[model samples]
Target: MDKLKINIAGLELKNPVMTASGTFGYGKEFSDFMDLSKIGGIFVKGTTLHERQGNPYPRMAETPSGMLNAVGLQNKGVDYFVSNIYPEIKDLDTNVIVNVSGSTIEDYAECAERLVGLDKIPAIELNISCPNVKEGGMAFGTCANSAANVVKAVRKVYPKTLIVKLSPNVTDITQIAKAVEGEGADCLSLINTLLGMAIDINKRKPILSTVTGGLSGACVKPVALRMVWQTYNAVNIPIIGMGGISCWEDAIEFILAGSSAIQIGTYNFIDPAISVKVAEGIKEYLDKHNISHVKDLIGQLSV
Candidate 1:
C-alpha cells in the first residue's frame, strides 16, 4: 500500500500535494524547477468559455504577510486550451486538472464540456469564484442556490471528477459546500482567497487596479483551516484545502483539519520546487509519527 496515496471521489492522487490554479500555470512552466510527476496533481491556470483580458495592469498588490490579486481570470479561452495547451500537457506523468471558470452557467457548462474528450485530463476544479455577470456580477460560490445551480449545470455535462473551489468571500462557506455536494460535486477545495484590499498611502489610492482583490499567503491559513474544518463536519465529500499553504507543516495542518489534499498557491512564486518538497515532507512526517498511511491522518484533529 502506498502510504501517501489517497483517492478523492474516483480521482486518485499519489499524494495530497497539488498546485493551485493560476499559481502553477500549466505545469509546463514549472518543469525546469521540479519533476512534474513528483507531486500528486497540478490544477492548471483558469480557463473560460471565451478569452478574458483579465483586470487591467497594477492588478496585484502585496500586503503584510500576504498578497492581493485581482488578475481577473485572464485566459485565451477553452477552445484555445483544447487546441493549443492540452496537447502540450496531455502526456505529463502527473494529473493535469484544469480550473474552469465562467461568467454564466452556460459558459461554465460549455467550457467543462470541452475537456470531456481529453484522455489525459482527469478532473476539473470548478472555480465558482468568478462573478456571475448575468446575476449582477455576484460570485456564484457566494450563494448556496447559485453555487448549486452552477455545479448542477456542470455536473450534467462534466462526467468525470468535479471539484468545486469555494470562495471565502461568502457568509457561510459550509452552506455553499453542502449545496454543491447535493448538486453532485465530487470534492471541494476551499477558502479561495479572502476578499481584501491594500492602499498606497503615498498615492492615496488603492494599490490594486480593482481597488480590492483576493488575499492569499500565510495570512489566510487560519481562516482556510477553520473553513475546511467546518466544511468537513458539514459535508461527506473530501475537501482539498488551500489558501496560504506554504510548507509541509502547513499542508499537514490542513490534512488534520479535513483536507484529503492541499494545493500550494502564492508560495509557489517563492519556491518553484516547493510542491515536491511538501510531498517529501509529508512522507517524512508520516514516518516519524508511525502513521502507516496518509489517509489515516485526514480530519484526525484532536479537537
Candidate 2:
C-alpha cells in the first residue's frame, strides 16, 4: 500500500485531499452520501462571530464550465459550531478544520480567540476570499499588507495550525503569498474563486442579485494552477491548493506544481463522492508508477 499520510503544520491528514470551505457545509451533511472518515480533512463553511443570512436570492449562476456564487458566507456562529457540531465529529477518522470569515480585523481576532482553546478543532482556515460583503473578506485578501495583518492578528490567538485562504482576484498572488508566509501563517489555500459576472441581455440586467459572484469549477483550473505554482515558489510553508479541482488528474497537477494538498470545491456540488473518487484515483496512480508515497510527487516537475 502507498503512504498517503502527510503533515500540514502539525495536523496529520490521512491523505492530501480536503474539501474547500463554503462548498462543504458541516461534515454531517454529506455523511449519508460518503463516509467522512474516508478522506483527509474537512474545511467546513466559513463561520463568523455571529450568524449570517448571506446575500439575496440567485446567489448562484452557471458559466461555461464553472459557476458563480455570491452566497455571502452564510453560517452559524463559531460558538454554535462548538456546542452543536464539534461533539459529534471530534472523534471522526479525519481532521476537522473550521473555515472562518469576518467583517473586520477585530471580528476575526475575537473569533480566533474563542477557537484557540477548543482542542477538538485541530485547525482554522481564514476565509479571506469572500467578495459580497461591504467590509473585510476578499478586500483584505487582495492587498499584501492587509492580508498579512489578518493572519498576524489571528496567529496571536490561534496557537494551532493557521491556514490562510487566498483570493484569486489579485494582480500578483506571490506578493500576497509571501506577505502571509512572513506573518506566521502555518499553511495556505489558494485561488478561492475568480471574480466574474453574468448579464441577462434580454432584461438588460445582471443575473445574480449581488450583480457579481466568485467563479469556481473546471473552467478556472488553469488560472488557479498558475497561481499555486507561483505561490509555491514564494512561500516556505505548506499550501492547500484549490480552485477548479474536480478529478485525480487535476489534483496531480497541483501536487507536481508544489501544492502539499488539494481541495475539492465545485465538484462536490455535482458529485458528493468526488473526494473519495479522487483519493482512489491517486492511489491507483501511485501503484502504477511504483511510488511508495504521495509526497514523492510534490514539486516533481520537469524543468
Backbone clashes in candidate 1 total 0
**Which candidate's lDDT is highest?**
1
Measured against the true structure, the TM-scores of the candidates, in listed sequence, are 0.99, 0.96
Sequence-dependent TM-score of model 1: 0.99
Report the lDDT tens digits of candidate 2 across residue range 143-244.
888888888899888889899999988889999999988999999998799889999999999999999889999999999999989888888999888989
Give the range of the ten consecutive residues with the poorest summed lDDT in model 1: 1-10
Tens-place lDDT digits, model 1, residues 47-134: 9999999999899988888888999999999999999999999999999999999999999999999999999999999999988999
- Runs of candidate 1 exceeding 4 Å displacement: none
Q: In angstroms, how far off is 152's CA in candidate 1?
A: 0.6
Candidate 2 global Cα RMSD? 1.7
Off by over 4 Å in 2: 130-138
